[model samples]
Target: MASTKKTTAAKVQAPIDNRETFVSLQKSFADSDMPVEEKLKTLYQLQAADSEIDKIIQLRGELPAEVAALEEEIADLKERSAAISAVIDQLNRNIADAKLAIAEHESIIEKYQRQLETISNSREYDSLNKEIENQELLRQIGEKTINDTRMEISSKKSELEDLKDRLSIRTEDLAAKKTELENIVEETAKEEAVLRERREECAAKIDARTMSAYERIRASVHNRLAVVGIYNGDSCGGCFNTITPQRRVEIVSNKKLIICEHCGRIIINPDFAQ
Candidate 1:
């Protein structure tokens, strides 16, 4: 007798990469039987998304520069403080050395006086007196050096205190600026992300030739507006140029792409303006 074995098939899933997804989207747009008005609508939607992104960027104007300026100021202040501290340290060392020199001079003068008491002749006593006089002069010089260094230390400490105060104020300012920038970024980040995705989807729906023309027109225009709808039922929204009846009829038909001669902006029917 022969036994039959049961067989099962494993299900395999195919992975889709980014390139495949992009090609699929491209094919859908190319082969779409959608009306011209729909395509123009998609293009206008892309422009609107891009404009919103631009507004978000504009809202953050000069904050980056201000933050950088604050950072630089803080660094300069720290460097100045360090330099002043080094000067103060050197001055303290100078004062210490002057005090040590004065002590040595006093010891030498005491030794000279002892020698004067033991001198056997007047000439030797006179020589001892001269030695003591020179040591006293050295002590006076050391005392003057100590006094000068102390005065310098006092002035530098005052300057250091002022710098510290300024640094504290600047640090507070920097913190406030950073917080403001962070808040702005946090507020706009998610909205910006969603708009970017919408812009990409809209861009994918537009044909390559139209997209290229749109980009060129947007770049050449002051407000980066490439597609504008009719305004006041007769004038171009972008340049305020009067749209002839024929042009208005052509634009409303959506049979072909039309651009304003004055501003080189693509014109759509007034109904499409949002």
Candidate 2:
């Protein structure tokens, strides 16, 4: 293993430019004494380890993602259920207040009617009748408020029930998916753990800029191969594109780091794969 350096590339290059540095990442470690072939070996080893881990992850067959989605849905439903509960509680309070207002209005109306019977003058009788009429209007308004609030509460409760039902289904789904995932993980756990450890060890040998470039390439490609050997003796292994004769000679020389111009994957000489 080579001593890893955290130095940046050339002063002209960004500290870590995945796009441009990918072509000639060796410049990022201009001061390193390790040969290019040795660096490519470490990078290839890292790719192998990652590929193995990817296969292990495939064994789970989307169970992990399903579990994650279910959990997210359950969380959202719980939040909505809580909000609906709060709204229902508020509406109940409104109904309670409306009922109280209706009771007060009824009492006032009763008192005004009694006063109307004892009034001796026409002016007094008119005033008592006016007070009674005002009280009746207020009572009707309070009853209408109570009716509207109850209807709203009923709607909110129905929404809450739907949310609860959905939450229950999602919770069950998450549990089942989690169990399946746990079983798959249990089977591959040992192999995956060892491969991951090897991957870290191999990655540590390479310089920072090369590692950054390799990671970016892996993420962009479907196969996740960032370092590949010469394919069928004269093609880019990653994309199967024909390599120029002159470039293939340089790649075989291994004096300088080489990459495929078409696919941008680091090209290791086929001889090295031996």
Deviation of model 2 at 87, angstroms: 1.4
Candidate with best TM-score: 1
Model 2 residue-pair collision total: 0
Per-residue lDDT of 103 in model 1: 95
Query: Which pairs of residues collide in candidate 1?
Result: none
- Mind sharing the TM-score for model 2? 0.59
How many angstroms is residue 130 displaced in model 2 relative to the true structure, after the best TM-score fit?
A: 0.6
lDDT of each: 0.80, 0.79
Clashing pairs in 2: none
Each prediction's TM-score versus the true structure: 0.73, 0.59
Residue 274 miss distance in model 1 (angstroms): 4.5
Superpose all Cα atoms of candidate 2 onto the true structure and report the RMSD in Å to 1 decimal.
8.6
Across 149-242, the per-residue lDDT of candidate 2 in tens digits comes to: 8889999989999999888888888888898899889978998999999999988888877788788777666567778888888899977889
Q: In order, how many clashes per candidate?
A: 0, 0
